[model samples]
Target: MQIYDVCIIGAGPVGLSLAAALQKSKQLNKVLILDSIKKPKFNKQGLPNQRVLSVTQSSREVLQSVGAWDKLEQGRVNPYNRMIIDESNGQDYLEFKNQQAHIIEYDNIVNALLEVYDGEIEFESKLEKIELKPNEYVTVNDKFQCKLLIGSDGNKSKVKECSNIGTYGHSYHQMGIVCTVERTDQDSEVAYQTYLSNGCPLALLPLYNPYSSIVWTAYMDDYKYLMSLSDEEFLKVLNSQLGRYAPRIKSISNKRMAFPLQSLQAQRYIQKRIALIGDAAHSNHPMAGQGMNMGINDAALLANCIIKNSRSGNDIGLEQSLEEYESQAKLMNYTTSIAMELIKNTYENKTISPLRQLGAKIINNLDPIKQIMIQYGSKHPLGPSQFEWVK
Candidate 1:
């Protein structure tokens, strides 16, 4: 048995982040990474279709710690200075503004994070097996007999599965069709969104000059038609629903792709010494585009947990600590998922329900409400609700 202090499963963002975080610990070492894909095998299918991550302040700090934040070009990732969220029932909108809310291309951030990794990566190495002894010592693929294990692969994480941890959610029946489109309006650096009676609202997130990232969520059946539409027809459909909110529409280019939306949470984030982080533990709807940012935050929390507890002369893989991490993560993930889904549901009503309209008016009219959201979304601007651990 190859005994070690820790072993990481999955080489995606969460996995890589965990591995990198562990490598940074002078108190810890003997970390090994095993993933199903080949090393450097990033999901490059969305090359043309840019991904925009709405990162919070805290998450941004985590990325910088791992050197991922510095790899991005200043112009590649644009800030979300303004946001327009509308109700389905009425023409009213809840708009928010912040000088600091930023957006980064998905692949750019991932590749950047991967660039700083300078350790063992056993890619194309699937989790063919996972054995957790009663002592909480885990053996993965009959290779790792380590004291700690982390599941950061993804929603369908094999580490979570092999451990027999139960899942507690289902699919949202919505798919996010993301793409890049050229914009004509030069002054449109702000983000814009519009609610449609046609179901599933469309969001136009500003990117660098002349391009905006479109995360169009629609029903299962409607997704095909939206994707199949030719550039001209697609632009027409988008113009009709989003023209008012979108900048001057020009050519829609880039790889357009769709991903099923889901709201999932593991029944327990820890089983023995193995801990789950990022999407493996909880997967939220992307309506808010905080998925990766949340994952980054998870990385930060666990990294701190390991560092704090290990220094206290306690086993970093204690059940109590893992449970605490889970409880904290579950609350935040569930809350964000529900909020995004609720906001999505409320956007399709033709009447813009009175209460919803009031919310729009309240948020739009009140700077505090808008700032609160910016703080919540950016995980910054410091508020009373901000957890002490994050600061």
Candidate 2:
């Protein structure tokens, strides 16, 4: 019997972020956030979570505005001033010298959002069912009512499923292996990745001092072989594979986790009074570290749309209002998703890899092109108008 202006399902960083942003913007008076999982706990003793996020400048701005950035422990945030991507052959290298990104523990972002969030969150509240009446409010499990429903749940979202929203995407036949690792040299603030002949790109992303998070994307067989090794043997293989990429891994902490890679997008981002964001709306390969970034953008854009709609005295959940959000967000997500897919395909195709490498070399030498790419990767370096909303 409790009616809220907005109810967001899934309390992950993206979902919680939306709740916080809405409250901060004063766009909605009452918002409800529900998640199946309990609140994420910060690891006090062991290694940080294997999951890491590359916070772009724009995303950092969003977090800063909501007070989440300040909530993040300063020691755990690693700011990478440079990034380099190249082939194992040392050809086709691209480097960005500016402060390209920051690596933050996943839980840090969530806790930060939680710190600033003043709205209601129902932990362990799994969404059992969702009822949707076109052009009307949505009902959740016959208990909660909301003028608008937002699904920030992951790829297999209950809200998206209950709304009968179709999706499109394909698996990359790859698995991403993630683990925390230590390197001998920690002075460098650069993140590095090398594309291997096997079509997998192994990246070393810096964490707090001396520690880094490894995201090695590999084919199924390669992944299986890597997983079969002991910790010591795995470290050796990693070092040997890197060849000349110095500062080898001294040791790896925590167990490695592997996830299937895919690019998925909902056929439509909105359905009547219900809308989807984050992984619920689109899930992309992690090669670019843009999955969560895209989700963050979704939350921001949706908040802006709702604010505009409410100010205009129009129903916030109406298709017209939601369309304004979907049009821009869907296009941006699609463009980035397709670009990533093409890069993956180009690298995976061994026959054309040489040409691809040549092309990369060409682009690397072109200052204007490289600068543009770097700027775009940093989330619209040209200006805030292109991508950023909500100031």
Candidate 3:
């Protein structure tokens, strides 16, 4: 059996990004990536997919370092230089006057990373089992052996379960519904989000000309009613609810999708030779738009940790050596998740609505507080530094 240096399960953006980042490591050799899903296929002239991500500037730097940012540019990339957050009562508001984030389709991101990645990737390889020996290595299906194993398989991580890692989190009563529509006005450059009286926050994310992606977070009953509406009826309600913000929904570009919201975190990120990253380690509420960013940051930190361990001539798979990666990532992710939960609870709970309004008002007037948030959301403090990649 050829024991590889590292084996990563799942070929999603997180996994692919890790692979690309590790390719720059001088000491690492022989990486194996496995995933059941085949590579995505996108026509040159198709509309952007409904599953889009709010990519932070920090994330763009990571992709740029790996020679993937230019790939995204070939597709539809909408740069929203500002964000306008307002409440239902229209009393308090917050705005950020910087190119903080961009809206990119999930498929475009995955495809871009896949283009610059160079490694042994085995597609249609569903992970059935993982066995990790305390002082030895990890075996996948008794065939592929690796000194270190990584799980980027998302919320239902097979590697996490096989390693006996426990997770704890409760499901929010809300469901997230997403779709893309064309607005009457195509000149808006800012991302707009409004908190409704019923606690549902509707977001209009800028896309290409006259189009914006909508993410409406609401209770299941509301979700069901919206889902049940006909095309025209849905447009009527959406236009009415968003009023002038959305103008009129000329048409629904794609099929709508919904999923339950929850915050799940694994008890431990590392066990012997195996470590979990991305959604496998933690899942957060979409209200913050930090789920993908956190996962990408995890990959970067873990890669740096591996590089440092290699330089010290230490076992990269040793749980002790990998402790720093886990500690830093868990701390950052936990803090962000908790903050997002508090925000969700504050507005979602009717009793605390006034308090939320008051807090927003206070935050609006406080420039320092607003700057802190913009700094955190726009770029991560400890992310990988900007680098010029050889194109």
Candidate 4:
């Protein structure tokens, strides 16, 4: 049987990134990554994928540490420096004029991470079984063994299931309709988000010139209705709802896709020799676009803990070392999850409309407060100041 120092399940951005980070440690070798699907392929000439991520500055640093940030195609990466926030009533609006985030396609991120990762990857290798032996390596699928098992799969993670980890979260009873749309205007450097009267938040995120991606969070019934509409009809409704806050939508440039929204957190980030990261560990609302950011932070933190333990000649899979990772990651994830929920509820509650409007006005006028908000939104508070392996 083959034995590895670490076995990571799921080869998405998070898993691939963790592999890249681990490779920085000279003492750690024999790392393996397994994914059930084929490796992701990026097409430069094809239309952008509907799924996208708002990569924050903190996440950019993590990618930079692994040498993956430079591998991203510059033309495809869109950076938005200005953000416009408003509501359907137009009673108030908040505008921020600082560097916020970058919009990148999901495939682009995975491809970049895969390129920089120097480790073994098993594509189409689904994990069937996991056996945990006390103070010993974990057996995967009865074929491979590893001292530490990391789950970066996703919300419906098989590793979490086999490890008997439970998750707690509630569905938002909403779906996010995502698509690429062509805009008539040329203001592609600004990102726009509007809270509609119906209690859904619609975001128009900039992409390459004349193209922007839209994430419209709608109630279940509204999502169904929107999906049922023809392209033209859907564009009409979208433009009407956006009003003057966003650019005029010319047409739908890509196929529309919808994903259910929910906030999920694993009861515990680690169990014996196993640890979870990414969506497997926690997930939050997309309103703040921090889901992937949090996951990347998780991978970075875990890599730090593992490397520190290995250098000290301590067992990397021991609960004591793993708890260091869990404490920091769980605190960040839980706090972000609660903040997102509060934002969602605050905007949706009709009785608090007046107060919400007043608060928006107040926030807009207070430059100091707005600056603080922008800094927090653009960076993760718990992210490492400097990666130990980067030096």
Task: Show how many residue pairs clash in every candidate, following the order shown.
Answer: 10, 0, 0, 0
Q: What is the per-residue lDDT of model 3 for residues 259-326, given as tens digits with 9 covering 90 to 100?
A: 78888999999988988999999988887688888898888888888878877899989988889889
What value does the lDDT take at residue 358 in candidate 3?
79
Model 1 off-target regions past 4 Å?
A: 41-49, 87-89, 348-354, 380-391
Which TM-score value belongs to model 3? 0.94
Candidate 1, 1-391: lDDT as tens digits: 8777777887777777666666666557677778887655345334333566766677666666666678655556676677877634476777677647676776666677677777777778888788878466787888668888888888998888988999988887888888889887875558876666665668888776777878888888888999888888898887767835557678888767888888888888886788898888888877677787677667766776776677777787778656666666766777777777677676655465777777777777788867777777777222112222233
Q: Which stretches of candidate 3 lie over 4 Å from their true place?
A: 89-91, 243-246, 382-391
lDDT pick, better of 2 and 4: 4
Evaluation by TM-score, superior candidate among 3 and 4: 4
After superposition, the stretches of candidate 2 with alpha carbons farther than 4 Å from their true spots are 44-46, 90-92, 380-391
lDDT of 2 by residue, 1-391 (tens): 8999899999887898778878877757799999999877876455778999888887887788778899887788889988778777645577777856899989888988988897899989999998886666788989999999999999999999999899998887889999999888865488887888776888889887788889999889999999999999999999877635546889988799999988899999997788899999998889888888888888878877887787778888888889978988888888888788888778778888778878877887787887777677678422224322244
* Candidate 3 lDDT for residue 99: 53
Q: Model 2 residue 231 lDDT?
A: 97
**Span of ten consecutive residues with least summed lDDT in model 3:** 382-391
Looking at candidate 2, the ten consecutive residues that score lowest on lDDT are: 381-390
- lDDT at residue 209 of model 1 (Cα atoms): 70
- lDDT of all the models against the reference? 0.73, 0.83, 0.82, 0.89
- Distance from true location, Cα of 18 in model 1, Å: 2.7
Return the TM-score for each candidate structure: 0.89, 0.95, 0.94, 0.98
